[model samples]
Target: MMAPDVARVESAIEQAARRGDFDNLPGAGKPLDLPAAHDPDWWINQRLASGEIDSQALLPVVVLLRKEFERREETLAALPDERAVREYAEDFTQRVHQDRRANPFQRMLAPAWDPEDAVARWREVREPRPAPTAAPTPEPVAESRRRRWWPLRRRG
Candidate 1:
């Protein structure tokens, strides 16, 4: 037996349907727009696409750290000097260690990043790029050899 509230809701829905409240509605007879392949994170993707959730916050801490490691050059390039880069690398390494300690189960996923190695990488990325060689100047053409086209005049 249905509860009184459920019975009342069904009756209300039936009354609305009879009154044509469900007719002429948007996509009433159209097939659902489903993905070609099933996606487990469809709702999360929709929320991300609709700007309802911050993509950065949605990533796992380990994943974030890995991304930071991958983009270390870009991060280091923004620093003012070697000292700042060193500090940042140290801080990043400390955070990695702390995360490993806090989540021992995730230790396998969060590889330890060496601060010294990060400093070396920063130096390599900071190296100045060689100046581009100047293009060879073209020899000037003789005035007599240069052709000039005259605009056509209307004969009419």
Candidate 2:
């Protein structure tokens, strides 16, 4: 699958923040010792001034921040867990099998999802896959052939 778009993620985080989604995140309603500065660039500059190095360059740091924000938004979005994911897969599969549109957006999302093959991907994650065998089994023991051949060819 294609890597998530950094810009899109950042934009989504900003949109969510504007809509108060972050404040509602799980474990986030409690008072936070959030940074005094609200502006991210200002926060970065402050960290720099304090001799705290952001090892990742600005773009990457922004992306990381965006992902954290997205996680918070997702948590607040009250999305389902593995069971829900499994249920969704089963439902979607049934819909497809029945030649129905499970969701209109699925058509748009399907192309990006197709190349990676979700069932195999989920199996890889869920199952303990066995390591590949190196070679076939060796031949088993022979009967009296080895002993007789050795006696016949004994050094005289």
Pick the lDDT winner.
Answer: 1
- lDDT of each residue in 97-144, candidate 2, tens digit only: 333243443332221122224444454555666998899888987885
Per-residue C-alpha lDDT of model 1 across residues 31-66, encoded as one tens digit per residue? 755667999877677678879888899777888888
What is the RMSD of candidate 2? 18.9
Best by TM-score: 1
In the predicted model 1, the residue pairs found to clash are none
Q: For residue 13, what is the lDDT in candidate 1?
A: 100
Evaluated against the true structure, the overall lDDT of model 2 is 0.51
The RMSD of every model to the true structure, in order and in angstroms, is 14.0, 18.9
